[model samples]
Target: TRATDSPSPDVSPDPSPSEDGDNSEGAVPEGYLGSWSGSIDNASGHSTRELVIRQGEVGEAVLTLTAEGPLATGGTYRCVFEASLTAEPAEGEAVRIGPSTVTEGEPMASCTPGSPTTLTLLPDGSLSRENTSSGEKLTYTKSG
Candidate 1:
């Protein structure tokens, strides 16, 4: 199980699908702030990623990197993966993402975008993404 009680920062509940359809709990589930990481391996190579999705003022999920890499590209990546459910550097979990693409893939695509990745809490207290960017599935996991 994940180490600390963590929660995504910005999660809109009761959002109408057309307008919004999901019936999410108001704000992220309790204890949805902490660290999470994951990794990935494909034809290109392998990489590890870790993010500290912490609570912010007015209760918004913010990403504070605890672990990254050298020469990693710089730019806010579409943090479409959930903190608990999908961000575990698991082998098969879909790291579905969006417009935020490194294009170059590895080596240069290491520096994560210095922005708060919008993390939404799922009803199951897990996390998920929508219209996330399509990039190399760099499996990252929480270390701290």
Candidate 2:
């Protein structure tokens, strides 16, 4: 991932904490708490995504993501997903969350309600979200 001191000009960082409480098992690390935004221009079309992660149950984190992009046929498509993620063991400064399950975001057949994703906290403080199934990657900076 690219290391930069700041996010993109159009990307606003929202560093606000999602909750105020002691860290618990499987809770997202303090560094990974908050909102992140990023975009990509691939063959599918230009798409922008925003992800919000919050502490969840004893062994899970709540991830809410919204993505919008142009459809191949025409027009734009928007999808929202709420997933339950579990922390995976990692080395060094990287934190990995995986085995994501889409608890919601139904009624949209295009949305993958059962696809697992990899969420990594890079050393530079940016978040890397990867779709394990499609191999789509998006680097996001903390929202401001």
Estimate the lDDT of model 2. Answer: 0.69
Residues 38-65 of candidate 1: C-alpha lDDT, one tens digit per residue: 5544344444455555433223223443
Q: Against the true structure, what is each candidate's TM-score?
A: 0.35, 0.65
Q: On residues 1-144, what C-alpha lDDT tens digit does candidate 2 reach at each position?
A: 777886686566654455434334454566777899999897887898888987665356578788778777676777787766555444443444455444444336556654667777888989998877888778999994
Predictions in order: lDDT = 0.38, 0.69
On TM-score, the candidate that comes out on top is 2
Model 1 worst lDDT window (10 residues): 95-104
Q: How well does candidate 1 score on lDDT at residue 142? A: 35
**Candidate 2 clashing pairs?**
12-144, 13-143, 13-144, 14-143, 14-144
lDDT: which candidate is best?
Answer: 2
